[model samples]
Target: MPTLSESRSRLLVSEAGIPVSNWETADSTQEAVSLAKNLGFPVVVKLCGDEIAHKTERGLVRLNLKTEDAVEEAADELLSSVTADDGEVTLLVSEQIRGNRELIVGLVRDEQFGPCVMLGIGGILAEAVADVAFRLAPLSRSEASDLIDDLSMQSLLDSFRGEPAVDREALINVLCALGDLGSDQEVLSVDLNPLIVANGVPIAVDALVETVEG
Candidate 1:
């Protein structure tokens, strides 16, 4: 299996009607700066390439950049950090999203069960919490709704602090979209982490897709 980079994976989800953070690809530091300015201050920059799959672990991601200089510096550092094995690296400038709630949605292939859709509590503590639910695909709107209800931490979906309650319809759409992908023969898996709830709508900030050669 081959893993798609963040930008490519994001495109896949976006095409499936999943909301994603605003972003653009940049081939140079100057281009990155220009894109960041257009996206507004407080953006994120990441080194992206087909072969650079584990960017965060490799220090290729920069977050909360508030100015042109910051974007430029981060873009330069990210580009410079690329290794020969990384292939053709580029910069991905994305809008910064903030929310108290983070959720995960994905598709996986189980040898015996075929395709399955997953939902869970996401972010850095995802592994520790491990609050997740799985359902066989392709899920109907009703099944997707039930899947969301399956999570043990239902309070996380409710209005918290000052943020509005998560829009359940939007989340259902996401799960259905993943289920749609799971039915595709070429798609091996899809991972959307930290689906930040902004203004009650879930938006994917990062994604990864694993695929098989057709």
Candidate 2:
């Protein structure tokens, strides 16, 4: 299995090839805090180690904070809950993705396609309404564009009321990056749900990267 870090999960997804975002690694609480501080306000803090599936389910994640002190508190809560008596722990703090909208983009391994791409309206919105879309890997710009249009809440992209329009190019880039990760790397699952958006900008709030056993 390819480690998300060693695999350069974010690096693999690019605007040059498709579209992408930035990522940083955190091996310690201090490091994660530093990263969160550098990334600026409204970021996420997560426990980024192996042997775990859903951080939220385990109470191993925190969201929407503006201070290092708050991050430290959240990190402590996550670290304490996810660690075993005999195991070590590592944390990853990400830039808080702010926006009124939330969305999910991920990849699933397929027997033939290797990796299949997925999209959905995220956060509580996705929960309330089951708006999701999927497509095969190695998609053309046209294919991706169509996939976006096919979404049930596609009109949310337009600048609603006084809100700004979502940076569609950026959103498409994130989805394509997930597809690329599944294609070029050996991954079991790539889940970035509640990839929050505010004023049309998207940032992955919670992520789950796992390896599939063959």
Candidate 3:
């Protein structure tokens, strides 16, 4: 399966009614700086391309840029880092989002079971913690809510460290949207990691979508 670029992945989920952080693409450092200014201070810049997956692992992502200079520098460096193997690359500038909690949501096609929706505790140690729940696609509102209850780290869903509790309805919609997206024959999988609970609303800050073709 070929993974869509971060921008494309975010667009795919957003079109499915999944919430995502505000972002824009720029072809040049100046354009990136302009977009960052429009998005307010403390932005994130990334080198995005259809062929360039695992950006963080490749050091193509620059986060917490608080000024135009920082955005410009990061954008320039990111653009310069691209190689022929990266196919085509563009600068993605988005608002910097923060939260005390993170969750993961996704869809997968099981060879036998077909499509399944997943919910999990996310962040840097997602795999280490391994707290997750899964259900067959085309879920009901009630079934989607059950997936939330299935997670072992229940406390994470509650108000913590002065942050509000996770917005259950919004999350349910995200899961339900993934379920709907799963039914699409061309979409192989969808991964939304570190769905930041900003002011209690789950907003996907990073996403990756696997599709059958470009």
Which candidate gets the maximum TM-score versus the true structure?
3
lDDT of the structure predicted as candidate 2: 0.66
**Ranking 1 against 3 by TM-score, winner:** 3
Clashing pairs in 2: 19-173, 42-96, 43-95, 43-96, 98-198, 99-197, 99-198, 100-198, 102-122, 103-122
Q: Identify the runs in model 1 with alpha carbons over 4 angstroms from their true place.
A: none
lDDT of 3 at 177: 95
**Residue 137 in candidate 1 has what lDDT?**
92
TM-score of each: 0.97, 0.76, 0.98
Model 3 misplaced regions, further than 4 Å: none
Off by over 4 Å in 2: 1-34, 85-87, 111-114, 125-128, 212-214
lDDT of 2 by residue, 1-214 (tens): 5334311334433322432234466766777778888888666776665455455666666777689888878877776676574144467666655567777777788787667888887775575687888899866666777778878887777886577887888777776666666655546777777666666777665555665441
Q: Per-residue error at 14 for model 2, in Å?
A: 7.1
Write the number of the candidate with greater TM-score, choosing between 2 and 3: 3
